[model samples]
Target: MTTARIYQRPKNAMQSGRARTDNWVLEFAPSEAKKADPLTGWAGSGDTRDQVRIGFPTQEAAVAYAEREGLAFTLFPAPERKLKLQAYADNFR
Candidate 1:
């Protein structure tokens, strides 16, 4: 199974609530290995294909980027898989 985590930049990291002019960033952490090679030696060292950072002009833009990149949107403490579950749970709910 593959798991992904998403995080948004805090307000203090931005400038005056302006995302375009400020630094609005998002990070995605992969919770699984990329390949099943036992001795390939491709783990950790920031090259494990398990981490990525993206910047945008606004929160909405960052969110759009996350969606486009197929990441789970958590938005700080609501829930880890809230967005992911909500996306599919609507059919059953």
Candidate 2:
């Protein structure tokens, strides 16, 4: 069984507004092992599915999709952001 991780988007450090936390993201753990090429020593990851990113509007929606797909998964809660209310006049100061 392939395992997947479900987590809400974290707010950006610079801007605590709802910029990036609009959706929940589902990421699959690497089903295949990655190896380095012997000739070039370049690393190549296997499976294009591992690179695919799916977004859900809500955390519950993300969980439902994983469950419906029969994917074993874990859910991580997003951190609460404390946004400071600043006025445009403060920028001059």
Candidate 1's C-alpha lDDT? 0.54
93: Cα error in model 2, Å = 15
Q: Cα RMSD to native, each candidate?
A: 14.3, 3.3
Q: Give the poorly placed runs of model 1, Cα more than 4 Å off.
A: 1-21, 32-47, 77-93
lDDT of 1 by residue, 1-93 (tens): 333443444444445563343445666555544554567865444345445566666667777776776766666432132234456668887
- Per-residue lDDT for 1-93 in model 2, tens only? 978999987867687476758799999988788899899998777677888889999988999999999999988888776669999999899
Q: What TM-score should be assigned to candidate 1?
A: 0.40
CA-lDDT, candidates in order: 0.54, 0.87
10 residues in a row with least lDDT, candidate 1:
76-85
| Candidate 2: Cα lDDT at 16 | 40
Clashing pairs in 2: none
Scored by TM-score, the top model is: 2
